[model samples]
Target: MADPVHKKTEPNGRYLIALSVAALGVVFGDIGTSPLYAVREAFGEHYGLALTEANVLGVLSLIFWSLIVVISLKYLTLVMRADNHGEGGIMALTALVMPSKLRRGHWRYLAVMLGLFGASLLYGDGMITPAISVLSAVEGLEVAAPRLEPFVIPVTVGILLALFLFQSRGTQRVGGLFGPVTLVWFSAIALLGLAQIVRNPYVLTALNPYHAVHFFTANGATGFWVLGSVFLVVTGGEALYADMGHFGRTPIRLTWFFVVLPALLLNYFGQGALLLANPAAVENPFYLMVPGWATYPMIALATAATIIASQAVISGSFSLTRQAMRLGFLPRMTVVQTSSQEIGQVYIPTINWILMFATVGLVLGFRSSSRLAAAYGVGVTTDMVFTTLLFAVVAWSLWKWPRWAVVLLTLGLLGVDLSFWAANIVKVPQGGWFPLVVGAVMLVVMTTWHQGRALLSSVLQKDAFPLERFLETLAASKNPPVRVPGTAVYLTRNADVVPPALLSNLRYNRAVHENVIVVSVETEEIPRVLGSLRAEVRALDLGFTRVVLHYGFMEHPNVPVALYDITELDLDPDDTYFVLGREIVLPEGKLGMPRWREQLFAVLQRNALPATAFFDLPPAQTFEVGHLVRL
Candidate 1:
């Protein structure tokens, strides 16, 4: 993956402009399209608030300040600063907060759990985002011609079907147009809002905080509950931070402030302005605000923008899954590098299909964006709260900020996040349970996999034969095994001990390779390991050498490539045979996790991606030695 350092330091030029434009496409797409449904949802019948001049101004104020406070101030400014080696996202933030050494009941452990849960919540968001965005965009047909409403659901499903099917082909070819098309999206929405705002200039007063304050005082609980609807505007806030690694903080922040932020505000205010003049537009203000002649064109453009948004979220999910696998929070899964030129561009077929089915199901089930909106905020708001908590740890523990500053900053951010969370919590009975259920399932899977790996590692280390004892026994043997000609590489969890695969090979074949290399792969907390520090090699008394390959949580491990890079070893790729230990987990024991969880772990272990594929090892040269272990 390209480092963010260059993205940050690149002087003002074409490269920077290009990056900013790209950021506008990938980073801002979700929030950019919020105009389609956010205002309508605010005035939705579920809230039960009658449309009035004051209510319109108040809702617009909340929308404006939410964007400024949450998106601009918190994510762009605070959470992004906690990037782990120029990478941002819940996974990266979790890596930053997690210490090299974690003790039982340590405070940082809680932070790690929260971060994992947050990352899990993103999967829930991923499923719902595409459903809602597309539904909302397609619903514009109802405004253009009420008779076309019957085709809205079918059309939305068709567009989503095409979008998900397109995932296998990757985003490289069409990614270039994402920026220019999104640029037009922002411009079009801005113009749409400007036209309405011109007619009802009085709506401009919503920019004042007074309107928001008075709305709460006047409406009391209703105003407070309405925050749930207003939160729709900032649901994409996490995307800004998650994608900071791609274009760096500079480009994202520039795009938000200069492009996305203004366009959103203008469009949101325009919706509010339209509501003030004609409350009848409340059903679909975004489309109704569109000029009659441009209704169909706007629908087409909006659909394009929504698909782009869906693509960004889908890509983010793939990236997050890879990060989890590398960090051992999840089981190994097939990850396909979709583009040779871009390391970050990956496609996980399992995840792609899972997301597609879940998204299409949601659209078919909910049948409208408004109902889907009920299920949307819980995950995103919870994610935001987790990001804030993780950021606090980085500020105080890692960055060594003053205690008072960290406390104040955390409280201020949490105040807003918690408020939104509270508003959305009441919605769980009304479609919000979907993401919660999904998050809970994911959390269980992640925790079970993580714990299972730890237990398996402990067992392997405990049963491992001592390296000294093995060597001494080998030297003393009267009839030693015949030495083979080719080099053998045994992959193990711990490099200090004899690999079980080697022992199994020795027992089965009664022979040893002429040159033996024991390799262990370790994942670090940072984004990328420096090339110079990637490999650590130690030679033994015999023709045996111990090797440890270090990789970052954001990287893929390629053993052959790393070994070949160590000029001292002069390892030959063609001559080397890779040996891996394959574990067959059994749930017959009583000492570990619950029986159900143990069974779950066993299933996951059985289905994990093979080492030959994951490590880029040649299948013909790679061999797996299966070992059964009871938990």
Candidate 2:
């Protein structure tokens, strides 16, 4: 098959600025809302730290440098460059590193597993982000209206429920407001922080690394543990890379440098300055930073910002799930394209409801964002470490960067990531286990499905008849039963082998269609395939034709729609009959997979969306040819 013809169109200056503005709302939301609870959680009573000059300055310094090194340098400079056809994320990076050519090696298998684990962790992050962000934002009401304290959880739950419900309707309508709302948010937080900094100019000293160094030296283990809470400042960093394809690298980079980075730094420093002037304000420093009259307004704006952040994470979850499904790491789920123009705007019903319930449960269980913070960083940190590992591999293998350069760069980033992970690891017992458990469950599901499919494919190949032989036999048959007028489309994973559906039809019906199309839907490693290269049709002997439909991992496959795009085939939609092979796994039979895994795979396969629904095939004309498989 020919490679997709891509027309690279560079965004003009004005359009680039527009995308940068838009990137702020989607890409920076989670990190943007970190100021609400990050610093407060670090100094909470659980950590047993006094609000002294050294501690405050040290924490601020850590936040500043983490943003600079982790988000700015590591992701933007290194990881973003390793995008798979302008798509970024842990999975995309993994695809780049462990392409099909490198899949057979044991080391590459390990790399793939790590990437899947990282992607699974992101799902956990998705659940926790909305819960914590919304809860923290609503907690602001406790300061603005102490009478509203009892209603915090209820309000957070309500807001979250509404958010998830609105997902089905799509974000296109309200998406326009995201940029403006986030712009106001960043501006407001920056100004609030600036006001506090003016009162305590000495807090500016935190910009120096000396205070952070002295902090660890003075506090010992306690300071190291504080790194867990401080790590929250960069929790949204992954979203920056994940959403890169939505907004592109240049805009995200520009927004980070000009807007997000500066705003976040100013706010962290301002919080430090506030703590210095009045230690008592530590209880709710983010809200207290606002003027007495502006408290209520700030609470409302903070809520809006957090909601936006939650929306971003939820949307990302949908996109990630779609990618996983296409990559065969997950079973097919109901994927609804929410927008006509934006191919990336998608909604997965299963993911949405799962997140909704998980987020609500977290709010009710943890009660406060500070408590939830313990559960947050472990998954985020683990994901970052995996990304760094994948990035190092891509740099060395794909980019062909010098071994020494890759080692030096990876080590520097890995050191920071490991430190953060080590700090968060201590919180596992203190509620951090939630995400790990979620990630573990997802890992099992993904790996089981992948292994099960592999085993099934291997078993099928063992008994498979060569397509050429099958075609020759069909053509030379002494007594051909009948000839059908309409087309028969048999879905297959392998083009070189005969599909079971075809063999089954031939055996039972003893007939052949005038137009037989052996259809194979292939998912490429990139984000999208161009229309020109979407389908490849080759004439075969007799009335048979081989049709291959290609889609990117980020795209949804509609086989019928793709078939319609083939002008030469002159396929009539009304006269087409789609044939799908349904495998009935007999776990009792000789299969390579473990008994438990085979059972799990069976359940998963049973629950998976039908090919008629998944491929958007017309149900009335679709036929499922069942086959019993020992896998």
RMSD to true structure for each model, in Å = 2.1, 1.4
For model 2, residues 1-631, the per-residue Cα lDDT tens digits are: 5556353454768999899889989999999999999889889999899888888999898888888888888888878887777788988887776673443598788888999999999999999999998888889888887899999999999999999999999999999999989999999999999988888889888889898898899999999999998899999888999988888889989999999889988898999899998999899899989998998888889999999999999999999999999999999999999999998999999999999999999999999988899999999999999999988888777777899999998899999999999999989998899999999999999999988888888889998987878888877989875888999999998877789998888889988899888989998877788988898888889888888888989888999889988988899999999998998877874566678888999999889999899999999999999899865
In every candidate, how many clashes are there? 0, 0
The residue-by-residue lDDT of candidate 1 on 467-577, one tens digit each, is 767888898999899999989999988888899999998899999999999899999878888787888889885688889998988788988999989997887778989
Q: How many clashes in candidate 1? A: 0
Candidate 1, clashing residue pairs?
Answer: none
CA shift of 494, model 2, Å: 1.8
lDDT of each: 0.89, 0.89
TM-score of each: 0.97, 0.98
Per-residue lDDT value at 154 in model 2: 91
Error of 2 at 548 (Å): 1.3
Predicted candidate 1: what Cα RMSD to the true structure? Answer: 2.1
Worst 10 residues of 1 by lDDT: 1-10
Give the Å shift of residue 369 in candidate 2. 0.7
